[model samples]
Target: MGSEIAVRVNGTLPAFSDFGSDNERAGEVESNPAMKVNTSCSLIIHENGKPTKHILVDTGNGVCNSVKQACNDLLAGRCVIDAILLTHSHPDRIDDLSLIVKEFDNVHVYCTQNCWNDVIKKFPDLQSIQHTSVEAGKTFEIDSVRITPVSVQHSNDALGSVAYVIESEGRKIIFGWDVLTFQNPNDPLLKGADLFFIDTFTYNPHPETNHLSVLQAYDLLKIWNPKEAFFINYSGFADFKNAENPYARVPKKPMTSDELAAQVMSDTIPWGYGWNERVKVASHGMVWRSTKQIEFMSPQFSEDMVKLFTEQNYVFSIKKGKKALEVTAETDIKNISYEFIKYDVESEGRRIAATTKGGFLAKPLQMLLEIDDSSDPAIVKIKVGGGTNIKMIDQDVSYQKDIHVKRVHADRLRDFLMKLTS
Candidate 1:
């Protein structure tokens, strides 16, 4: 058996002069004049038997004062953080980094060149400590753990954002925060892995340039298939508990093409997705874990599959003598509909076969398998109103449906489908 490592959460907020308690200070920090804090900071403790490695992913607003106190109070001063890994240069993520560097003399700070520049530009006082400017596809080792930085698209205009893939004790874990989407769904760097932590900022029809919606994150969960996946970087609009659709948020802006290419480099960056069950409404100190196992519960699909079906506009049709059936539809982003035509066929003997299409068909279908089962051999045909389409296929079929200009579930059906699928 591999080493049993325990992850201790050393999260903290900024220390305000007015607030006497840390909790009160965190509340003030969120609405203060310094910066509009959108997310919290986190510290990960990776211990492999006698050799322990402490990795701090983000230094929240309070300069890590909360983390140091929390660790001392929780772990009785037994935990010694070895290094700091920053996901981005956002104020909420790196405000306390300078304080951390000054306090810990032996700790090595790791971040992208762009993040480094942004930090130095804002806080010139942090120029003294050792800083390693990380590049995409490069791996750095600290004690028994090896960390690889993967570039991610962010809303900033600086160097770029990044996610870390940490390998230790024979296990690989990905820390993906503040990313819009997994750049290339087919990229090898996003293949099989033990665990993944992703952004769950919004749900569907992403609103801004960066950040992942609840629906987008689920779609990624289906593709990456990590043993365990958790959502981070939440917003005030999110309500994890009692949330009918649990994962839903407005989309953000997208990362540039160059940023995407730089982030996904290897074929082994494991995949998984889930909401932040602990902290809802932008609360702090939420965490989740993944169970490292790859099971074929259903067919794993991607954005490419959605595109292929829509681009061809092939409808489902049954041949006089054939066991397989096929259909397709296409549309643009503006006039896109969410209703997907599920292709199903009931053979003369009641053997059922079916598939679905919609604005985001692949992910919904993947989730559908978890709740229901298809029966009978009847070829079902439907159209995915929105522009999204399936990019990949798995099984072989014989019949094809040529659906031309059908618009029954154009609006109501589309809305219903978005709610169900997302």
Candidate 2:
């Protein structure tokens, strides 16, 4: 179960400047080289639950002594880091590699060709350090984990960015960030990830050089159907609490802290969406475990009314108010049952009465009753049903003549009456 592991380190880098305190912001000039917060960097370790032969992913802005301490704590004083895997060669992501190499003995660094060149230019003193350049579609083994790099587009000058697909313990995890979008529909390397961490920088479609909006991420989830998905690379403006845009939707899947810990410990979840999806944004350091399942419950409708509408194949319209669901259905008058009571026809031949359903009797029926005739096809109005008053629209009034009933049908009237009360 302990095949892969990751830890968030403490150190301010230029990338993390947004997360720094205001006082700390003033001291940026003299801050430790390792304390730079250029971007978010995470240390990913892959092992077969062994201290030896572990792999570390992205050392981050390696200047913080606290970060080093955190790494030491995670290692538990076992073997030193065996290898370093770089996602990209940005300064914040790679600046700490030299410090890591200087502190540890015989550590091998693995990166893409462009990333390796960038690192070499910055750390000429560590030229003797062992480095291996990799390309897209290449698979490399790190203990029990298999890592495959997939090419992606980025906003960086060196456009050759790559995301990793890590396979271990019979499951696959995809790490996708910095890519503008999933533009390649036929890329086989993008398939079958059990978990995906995608970049969702904005709530709406504010096109940038590289990044995805929350809506784009949701569309990907519907298409990929990953067991779990998380959004990462989020901007402060895109906080969930402030997410009022209709397009920015959260994942429908359930998640828990224990599940997040398991994903992190196994290194089965990537950094972006997976991490963001599981985050609880309340008080700092406050933890909770929710065992109850969270479900999206829709509005409730009366079972009888729903059944009636379904059976009649009626095209109903629904509107939601503050407290209730308002529904309207149109049906043919002949379908209604009129079994009970008799009518007294006057010389003018019109009958008027209130329905048990609480609606006033209207028009064509009124005209026919006045004429004392059953020969005309007239519209009979059931004024109020289910607390909602029904009004005859243009189609209802113009399409037919009215029928006057001296007595209402017991069964049909009972059904209609039940609809009102129920």
lDDT of each: 0.46, 0.46
Task: Tell me the tens digit of each residue's lDDT in model 1 across 174-285.
Answer: 7776787554556556656566667765334444636675457667766776665555454423222224444433222221111111222111133312322211222233
Q: Root-mean-square deviation of each candidate, in angstroms? A: 17.9, 21.2
Clashes within 3 Å, all models in order? 66, 33
- Could you tell me every candidate's TM-score relative to the true structure? 0.50, 0.49
Worst 10 residues of 2 by lDDT: 281-290
The digit string of per-residue lDDT tens for model 2 on 78-186 reads 6376777776876656777777787878989877988888778888887798888888788988767788888877666645577777776577667676666554634
Q: Where does model 1 exceed 4 Å of error?
A: 9-51, 73-76, 236-283, 286-422
In model 2, which runs have C-alpha deviations exceeding 4 angstroms? 1-14, 17-50, 62-67, 183-188, 237-422
Candidate 1, residue 337: Cα displacement in angstroms equals 43
